[model samples]
Target: MTQPMVKKMSEEQQHLVMQSMDMMDRFYDEEFGLLRSSGEESSAHGTRGSAHYALGLLIRQKSGDVERAVRVLHKVLDYQYDAPEEIYHGTFATQSTDEHPPAGHYAWKSFAPGTAYFLERTFEKVSEAFIHKLQEENNLLKEEADVKQLRQLFYASVHGVLPPVWISYDPNWREFIACVCAIASAAFSELLPDALIQRMDEAMERAVQGSVDRRLSDAIPMNTNIELMHIFITHYYGHRLKRADWMQHADEQAEGLLHEFEQYGGTFAEFNTTTYYGVDLAVLGMFRRYAFTERMTEIAHRLEHGLWNNIALYYNAKLENLSGPFARAYDMEMREHSSIGVFLYLLLGKGYEHLTGMNCESGHDPMIALLGIDVPAEAVPYFQAHQGDRLVQKQFLELCERDDPKANRNLCTASAWIGENRMMGAMSGSRNTNGQMHPATIHWQTETGERYYLRLIRRETGGDWNSHLRGITFEAEVTPDSLNIDVQLDTAEEIEVYFEIKGPSIRHQDIQPERWELPGLTCTVKAEAPEPTMLMYTDYAEIIYRYVPGKSENRMRFELGISD
Candidate 1:
């Protein structure tokens, strides 16, 4: 896996590479002499810098522009520093300028470790590529001292007093931090001073120890990829660090991952069908190549295949949507077809045609070049079958469970893909309203040629004491152009179900309980229950569907005539 790459770029690839460079040029703030959103006095400074660094490297490698790459590289180095007395305080501006309060203010300047790691890794790349040239010419843009300062800053930051805040509660973040910490420590181990080496060792020890200690202290929930990385780092350096129970947590997570993969083929831990799948797949691929033990390799391959299975199963190439009543989702806007599909193409060479006209953004996983991993032949069939001349890709899961901390629930969800429109619905399971998992979500192109997304919610009152009413015993029937959701409630209390649709060419008129219409498109909305319901228009439209306890299931049927 570590062998040097002999693959050369094709003419078409060369064109796309140049186009990517052009797409990335906007992110650089020439006037401010820094990256866009690189506002030290504003929020998200670290992210801007990190994005700049990664995109810069891609440009540098693509164009072989040393001066251009150095400009972006300096932003990272100039942002980081090493102070003799106050290590943590003088490191990086915790977040933004406002975050840097008056002298004694206790705003913990916890630099985002994941962002730091991303920047540092890219820095390593740029250093290896352009540092020697800059040193020879004395470019005055960057120097060996800048590199030395960054190395010292890495030491101080990783081995500081408060132990890198570990920023978010997201396991993805932590896993990234842990993996980068291990790799960074290894990369600079011999180069670092003895004291820095001990410090790095101690810091890593604390992280490993902290993870184990947390498992013992708290009922640790499992993140499959996170645990795999943890397991790798611990096992890789366990001999040096005297921790007997180090691998236990990671082992538990790996076991959980294997079980889920065997059962479901792959699990989408996050709701976004597009971003997370690619991120997770890339992470798994990294686990396979970087941590390539026999057992790890087997586990990694199984997980990768499982993910590909899901991607193939749900992909709607015509619509460029993952056609989902996603268990969890960030928003209704799913770019899975473009982004995740590209990653899949890179992993398994045959899928590249799916990405033929899709937008490939900057700041994607750079490991496609670094690791030099190739797509396996086994995955080609899966990609081929999904990307055919099919107008619709329909799928249903009887019982799907997600291990989200906020949402430890299960539901029956179905996907109906008709061209570029996706009509997805879920009947049962407690949904995190923040995730926007309405009972029925219809994403369809109107007859007037505009994309529309509609969220149909069955809001119930007199249910449980909680504000959010959880639907129990859900039944969903999926058709080519419609979805009928039959939901059972906790109480027979009266509920108000409404539809809020937002799109370019959608207008509501003649809104009624039995009959509502959207002009220009052959779409109609009708609600019929066991009893009469009140219907009115608020922001969108509302229907008060009454549910009698122990009597019948509340049924809401939505239909669209924009399908073949």
Candidate 2:
């Protein structure tokens, strides 16, 4: 009877599981505290409130608290509120202020209902055996306990809800909501009435069959999550829906999107290494786990490979950083390091040592576990590539070629200086915050000095030096210490350029007519308008150079000598 010894969990594995459960519990408690203190009454309404509640329920399900999970689900089913009419029209207000409420307050039309749909599906899976027992214990399955509210939401979507002006913007919201509807129609075939189920199927069709605005083209394609949702819907709900043409259009769109990396030498034109790329990679891995056609599956793999290649190009292993010459960023304070790659290891079983800095112990999102993916062996090349580079000049130069002069956001070039003494670059803005009341130019001086900031202002009657034109082109020749700028505007208006040198205790004395000398810095102003106005301060010097445009072009050169 010396048969086989029973297998047991390793001590380390047991410890990790316990630690993860503890983290999930704390996260739920914190979200509960926020809901209570913030005066948000219901768990099934509003944007952040509903999200917190749904997340709480999901955490309970993961922690084996099914009774509590069911209690929360009932609260959601019992919740009631007015659905905004605008949602049915597919139009949402973007502004949020003291007077106007956010569009997300109306759950059904603004992609807020997808969270509920997802939660409902999760409940079905985890409570399969306990469903009748739950009803027996608490009388949870009354006639009113039916999913009528969800049905109403589905009804509005199915019959072609249209706004006065319908535009194909925010594809992420539209696609995700539609995907959930598709999944729900299939999953709840037996539970829901046939009429409601038919409408759910129609809603899924309407969502995927919708059109995009051809006029406003995106720089990148619809994100990987949107693509994955399309694949999932097509795989599971295709037979119930009628959309052959739209599926063809999607393939074309994917082809066009993937063509960018091939054309740009393995990089997206706009290299945003922080939030957008990280989120895309994580979601893409999740969807890769699902079954799909061979073509779609290969596309998903190609997408992951390209994303990893781009990420690896910017990675700095020593500092655990994702360096950037980002087109649009959160603010002026640039990121020095990011550990989002560790999420790849957590979600997909790949890229383990290629990234560092993120702590996997704190990850408690149920979606990560529910949709876990395995990395293919083909993606190993991206991981094995060099992960550290001081300067990414070639990649950024490619981006510089595609910069739009009329864009309101800052268009930054690659690093001109990435050394022991300093790290710097340059950018131009039209009317953005960084532009500061005029068309602006900046030479990024992070480790060197405070910031060398400039803005081109229009000098007009009433001594008004505020407004700047939109149709202006800014071209630059950047060096380690100087930025030679050429400005050309379609308008003939007079513009004045303002420049300032900021640092710690920076004092300057006049060296020449237009040259100002400071400790470790020298600035010379070249104007095309009138006599320059110079103002000296304790920590900086401000110079105003007026520009009177000629027929062809106007030139202004700022020569700054840096010594630190």
* Number of the top-ranking candidate, with lDDT as the measure: 1
lDDT of each: 0.45, 0.40
Tens-digit lDDT track for model 1 on 268-360? 344335645555665665666555356766777777766666665565544445655554444455543334645544544543544534343
Span of ten consecutive residues with least summed lDDT in model 1: 81-90
Worst 10 residues of 2 by lDDT: 90-99
Off by over 4 Å in 1: 1-44, 47-172, 180-244, 265-272, 336-338, 344-362, 368-439, 445-452, 457-475, 486-503, 510-521, 528-564
Per-prediction tally of clashes:
6, 2
RMSD of 1: 16.1
TM-score of every candidate: 0.58, 0.50
Local distance difference test, candidate 2: 0.40
